[model samples]
Structures are given as C-alpha cells and as structure tokens.
Target: MITDRLSLGLQLLRIIVAFMVGGYAINECTQGFSSEKWPTVKGKVTSSTIKEVFTRSGTSHHEADIHYQYVVDGKTFKADRIIFGGANFRSPKELIEKFKADKPVEVHYKPGEPSVACLETGVNFTVLIPLVAFGGILAFMAFADMSKSMQPNSSIGPRPASNSSGLAQPKMQQVKGIILFTGLVAAIFGFKYGINAIHFGAIPGNAIAIVVLVGGGFLFVTFISLLPAAAGMLARARRFDLAEKVAKLNTKIASTMSAHSYETAVAYGLQAEIAQEQMKYPQALELSKKALNVLACRPKVDLAVNKFDDSTNRMIKESTIRYEKHYNDTESLCNESYGSILFDMGMYGDALTHAEKAKRLAQDNLRNAAAPDQAGTKRALAGALALRGKIELAIGSPENAKSDLQESIRLRKEIPHQFEEYLAASMADLASAYCVQSEFRMAERTIEEGLKIVEGSNKPSHRLAKAKLRAQLADVKMGMGQLSNAESLLMESLDVREELLPAGHPEIAKTYLSMAKLRDLQGKQRDAIGYRRSAGEMLTNCFGPQYQAV
Candidate 1:
C-alpha cells in the first residue's frame, strides 16, 4: 500500500542524508583539528586590498584580501590565508594599516606541506560544532532504522486491545512525532552551547552555560512527563492500574489550587464532576462535600468594609453585610455543584432539592444585600437554574426544564463576561430539552449557536464541549429525519472526541451510540450493530457492567 511505500521512502531518505552529512562533518573535523603541531614563521605583507560587494538584494558587505610571503624550509612562499578554518573580516582602513607593504607578521604553516599554510592555525568554532552535532543526530537515526530492520518480527509485539476500563491508547505516530520534535529542539540547544563554548573567551560563558543547563533541564522534565502517557498507550492497562497516575495528576492540580485560593472550591467541584463521569458516585459525593466545606471555612474579608468609619458602627454593619453576601454566594455555588453531581447519579429528587436551595439562597442574597456582588450572584443563580432544569428534564417535565433553561441562558447573557464552557453546556441542555418536545428546528438552532460559541475558544475543554454540541446537533438532525446530515455530524463529532480525548471516554461512548442510531436510521443494520457494541463496551468499561446505559 501507499503507507508502506511512503514509510520505506522516508527510511531510505533518512539513511542517505544521515550518511552524507556524517561523512562531511567527520571530514571537516579531522581536517580542521587533526594535529596542532604546525610551524610558525615571520612573513612580510606583499599586498593588501579591501572591497565592498553588493548583491541584487541591495545588501552590501566588505571583504579584505591580503598577500604575504614567508620563508618556509629556506624557500620563499606566497600565501593569503588569514585564518586556519574560515575567512576573517576587517574594515578596509584597518586592513590597509595592519598589512602595510613589507610589514612583518606571524604565519603558521604545516611542516610537510609548504603550500598548505595559514596565517593562524586552530579549529573553526563557527562550522565544526553545529555540523558535528547535526551529523550525530542523523547518524543515530540511521543506526536506529537499521537496528529496527534487523529485529525479528516477533520482537515487535502487537499492541493490547483497548478495554472498557482502560485508558485510551495514544497513536504511536503522534507519540513518535512529539518525541522527534523534542529531540530536534534539544539538539539545536546542544549545537548552540557547543558554539558558545568554543567562543568562551569572547562571550559570557557562565551565563550561557546556565541558560543551556536550565533549558536542557526543562526539556528533560517535559520528556519525563510524556513517558507515562506513552507507556499508557503501550500497556492499555485497566482503570485499577491508573490509581497512581491519577493521584500524581491530582497532586499537581492541588499544588496549583494552593496558589489560587479563590478557585479551590470550584476546582474540587469540577473534580467531583469528573469522578461522576468515571462512575464513582461515592467519590463524587465526597469530593463535592469537601468543596462545600472548603467554601464554608474560607474567610471573606472586604477591605472596603474595613475602611469605613468605625465610630458610627458603619464598619461593623458593612462588614456583616459583606460577609453574609459572600457566604450566600459561595453556598449557592456549592449547592449547585452538589445538585449537578446528584443529577448525574440519577437522583432527580435529591438533585432538585439542592438546586432549589441554591436558587433560594442566591435570590435571598440579591434581595437583602445593600451592595450585592452582581456578577457572582448572577453566576450562582444561573448555575442553580441550570441544575434545576437538568433535574426537571430527568424527571420527565420538559416544560419546566425548558423554562428554567431559558431563564438560565438569559441570566448568563446578562453577565458582561460569561464563562463560555458553561454557556455552551446550558445551551446544549436547552437544545436537549427542545429535542424531547420534538422541536427539532429549535433544538438544532440552539445547539448550532452553542457550537459557534465554543468554536471560538482555543481551550482543550472547549473542544470537548464543541464535540458534545455537535453530537447534540446530530441528534436533532436524526430526529428531523435528515439521516445524511446526522451521519456526517456524528462522524465529525466522533473525530473531534477521538482526537481530543482518551479511548473509552464517556464522550466517545456517547458519540458511538449516536453513530449507531444514525446507522440504524440509514438501514445499515450490520454497521449499527457494530457501533452499538462498541458503545456498550466503552460504557461498560467506564461505568461498569451493571451501568443502566450498558
């Protein structure tokens, strides 16, 4: 096939280029610094000239030419070598003054070869190091290819099949590309360091060395970080084996949270959402509880309240109001988060209870406060409303869900700077509610708007959100009896999810389910069955065999 031919061509090109570059570098190194035993003699300048040359690009440069005669082995020798490895440059006037007619200067010449002589003798820093480093990299690639070719077919074992409970394996091609790019960057830095080291006397050697060392250190850390991901792809181990990896990632996240106290509660709340997706209900609950506790214990000190007059008890009143407002806002957020997790776990009643409490707290804070946090209050209220909408939809109340979602979307748009991901999610939920009512056109429009909002965001999370919106749009299309459009959208959504997410992720499974439905609508029973089986396997891995969806 074409792929095999392309691979073979690339391998051959690498081998050929590596050998050619390596040979040239070796030749230059050997010729430049083979032996430093050249003899030096006094030479008299015979002639000197300098000229300015301009190219068609309108760039002008200067060059100096000088001729000298030296007595080597009792024979007069005429030479014009200014440097051993490369040409040297000087101003026209400087060259003329330095190399005055009959002026004596020192010259270094090879003992056995009088004709091969130089005014100076040493290695060339500008040429040797970069070529050698580049050549070495190419040579290594060539050697590696040869080694791979010689290895037995059995030595290269088959990759493990992806299982439901296992993390998705990254493509080997992607991994290799990352590694190669990183190696090239490291090699470039090495070549620069080599150049700098050769000119140690002319540059700040210590500073350059420190910079190179720090750069190399960062590259090493980056490579080490990618190792676990690459290894996961190779092993395709079950979820049970991922505990340590998850812990390490969580530790890093915790460290980041420690530096941003304002985000701690929300961070934990988000983690709880992820736990729910992994089918760990108890863990999700525990995480949400921790988020609530964190918010409760968090201190809120308004400097403005403290700066007010203390004699008239104004400071005390303001402090109390500020504290109450802050407390209510935080509580509302925590409650909304808890409700959302409960909703995911299919506890509609419990979720609705928390959602209502959140909504009430937010509204009360808005009504009673002298100067409420309008942004915070709106966000809390919107979240609560969205949660309630989701719970209502789950309990088969499409009208109530539609009303709440509309209100939530209205509140979100009122904010000057809204969170894109949340807005997209709320829009998707609203579209889903519309779909339940068989309002396919409205659902399609809502989801398309959500997709547009998310498409402008460059964040990885936004990409996943966009994929979900696309899938929801596909659902609307399917409901409207547009099978071709639905199939195209579903395939697009699947591609995005696969590129952005690990194998067997819940979103990927959902995309597969949608694809199965599309295939069934198209009367492709065999393809539909295959897609359904794939979705079921993924769901079983993520949510366990007893998962209702499975």
Candidate 2:
C-alpha cells in the first residue's frame, strides 16, 4: 500500500515538472520579444559590479555580475541590471582589463524587462518543455493520491484470472506501474528533444508533433485494451525488467569483448612492426604478450546464481566456456586490434606489427573484413605504411621513411572517398621529411599541394591538414630568413590547431611545443615557458602520466 502511494506521488511530481516546463516554453514563445520591440543597440558599460561571490571546494568558483547600462533599445533606459553568472570564468582581473579596454558591446533588451538583456542571442526551446511536463505530471500524481484517499480500501490489488481456486485476481498494481513507466519514457524523450533543440538547433518541431499525436493515439488504445493485463503485471513483481537488464548486459559484454580483442591485437602487431623498423626486440615481445592476454582467463564459480534474475549472465558464461577453444585459436584478431591501439598511441613499431598481420589476414580471408576494401582496411593500410615511414625517420633512416611514405601516398590515391584527407596526411609526413633534409623549396611546394587537397574535404582533418601545412610553410620561411612570413603562417596554424584539437592531445601538445621552441629562438623566455606549460598539460591529458617521449 505504501509502495503504491509512493509511486503515485512520484507520478504527480513528474507531471508537475513537465507541466511547468511546457508552460514556461509556451509563455516564452508567445511573448518573446519581436525584432521591432527588441531592437539591436550598442551600449557602453557604465559600471560593472560583482554582487555576490562564493567559492566551491576545489579549483572552481562562481559569481554573479550586475552591469548598469545607459542605453536600451535605442531609447535611454538607464540603471539596467544585467546579471552574469558562470562557473570558472576568466579571473576578475582579466575581465576588468577587457572592460577597461572599452571594447564595443552589442546588447538586446526587452522593453519591460531590462534585466533580461543579452549580449549574444540564440533561440532554444529545450529548456521550457521538460519543466512544464514535469509540473503537469506532479499535479496528476497528487490528484491520483487524493482520489485514492477518498476510498478506505484503495490499496493496489492483485491481478485477475480465474485460477484453480475460482477467484478473480485484481490487477490495479500492474496498471499503475505501466502508466508510470510510460510517463518516464515520455519524460526521457521530452528531455532529449529539449536538449537537442537548445544546444544543437535540432528542434523537434514537426517530428515531435507527429510523434506526440501517434504516441497519444497508441497510449489511448493501449490504456483501453490492455487495461486489465497492465494491472496484473503491476500487481506482481514482474520478471520482465530484470530480464531486460540482463539481456542488455549480455549484449554489452559481447560487443565490448569483441572491441577489446580487436584493439589488443592491433596494438600488439603495431608494436611488433615498429620494433622491427627500429630494431627494438624487447618492446615488440612485450606488446605481443599484452595482445595474447586479451583472451586469457581463469576458471571461477558463478558469483550470481539466481536463475530467475541472472539467467542471461549464466547463458553468456556457458557459451563463452563452451567456445573457449575456438576463442583461443581466434585470439590473433585481438592482437591486431591491440596493435591498432598502440599505433594511435604513437607506438609506431607496435602499430606496424599489427598492421602487417591485419594486411595478411585481410588478404587471405583469415580475418573478418569489416566491409569491403572501401571500409577502414584501405585507410588502415595507407596509415600503417605512412607510420612505418615516420618510425624509420624518427630512428634516423630518412631514405626508408621516404620510400614508405611514397607507397602510402600511392595506396591512398587508389581509394575513392576521403582521399583528400589521406593525401593531406601523406603530404604532411612527406613535408616533414623534406624539412628535416633541408630541402626548403620542395617542402614548401609539398605543404602547399597538401593544403589544396584539403580544400574540398571540409572535415576537421582538413583543418588539421591546413594547420600542419601552414606550420611547415612557416618553418621553410623561417629557414629562408623571411621572419615576418614565418611568424604569420605559424600564428595562423596555431590558432586553427588550438580550435580543432583537444587541449591535451599529442597533436595540440606538439603544436604548442613548436610555438614554444620558436619563441625561445626569438629570445622570448617568458612566452616560451607559458607555451611549455600548455604543451605539458595537454600532453599529460592526451597520454598517461607515464608517457614520456611520444
């Protein structure tokens, strides 16, 4: 009885929240200022005051700012309060400096609500709908509780079917549960749609209308037809929920196991190949061992033995045990996956070993080709070859690096889509080689050509390619003593790289390091130290703390 009451209470809470969100959205939609009423206007910041300040436990703090303005919507509406609150904002000193610079500011203000002024404007509906829907749900749940209260014997009853004893079972509990579940699913969709609408501009407008109508029709019919059955299910502890969870877990384990196997194999093989290139035998052997362990296991008793609740887990265990021999034989795939992981980690030798094994398997049909040659295989081959060249270059074998890079370029040209990105990548590698060899003119041309190929790609890699090319072009210009040109190109590349790559990614770290070196060369020790710190932070994030060189 208490459980039923609590469930009803939760439903009411949900309804109330939903209704509030919807109401807010509708109000905003209907009364949100028109362009005429909220004309765009320039404002000078008369004074900015920090109204409240608070420190969170750690390295973060929050504060609210009130800005007084002299202008509003082309009419002088003075003493307006514009609230600004954000966690981890730029330091107050930095903000004050920016303000003191007297930067031109653009703002929008509603006529009656001066506090509602905004600097940047973007439309979003996600915030409104969910809150309203929750409010509505809360109200409905409360009403349900009150209605139940009117009857003294209002406990959720048992489900109905004429059993051997010939008594009709009650199913009120099941009905309530189904209703609550349906409402939760609806709430989830509402929240998803709301978030996407606000953040991604993928407002669920027409699609949402269709869904609501269709879903409402379905629920109405189901509520009428399965009313008795739903009540029955809710009345008893349903096995369906636990079964579903176990089923999902089984799927996840299978998928993750496959992925883990593949990554392990690839990382292993890559280390082997790179080791062969660099003649690092010990490292290669270690990587191979890591790959082998991906499938290694020990026997143990079942931890969860509940047949009713954990049947799916037991089934997975039995199947895996039955296929242990087969899995052992197929462990090479895991090694290949591990090798790939190593390659991505900049472990060139290990990446090559895996690539070699994958190449052989793919050609011989020993491994499952994800799709056709058009899938990842083609790119993988090209990348492996290029990485091999890079490893050779790093180990002081310039000639070998050149040869491998050329082959990679040739392989990339044969592919259909994403060819531009591949070409840009190969060219970047080639330009690096040319730069190292002091072939400035050839390096410049290669970088330029690479940038041209990236033009139509429009992918993030395209931007990355452009950044790399510009960076290399700067190097060439610097070599030629065109300091200004070098500076310009390097700065542009730095800006693009900072935007695209994560702060701690190896690529970003390398870019920062380069900038730091350049600054040091220019006798800017302080700037160099700043860049060094940035590079170090990014590197630590991209790779583990133990990662030293790469």
Compared with the true structure, all predictions reach lDDT values of 0.65, 0.51
Error of 1 at 400 (Å): 0.9
TM-score per candidate, in order?
0.50, 0.40
Q: What TM-score does model 2 achieve against the real structure?
A: 0.40
- Write the residue-wise lDDT of candidate 1 on 14-108 in tens digits: 55554554444443333344224556788889988877889777999877778899998789988776653345333667767777778889877
- Candidate 2 residues lying further than 4 Å off, grouped into runs, are 1-349, 355-378, 544-546
For candidate 1, report its TM-score.
Answer: 0.50
The number of clashing residue pairs in model 1 is 2
Please write out the lDDT profile of model 2 over residues 316-347, one tens digit for every residue: 66655434423432343444444544654667
What shift in Å separates residue 16 of candidate 1 from its native position after superposition? 58
Question: For this target, which candidate reaches the highest lDDT against the unseen true structure?
Answer: 1
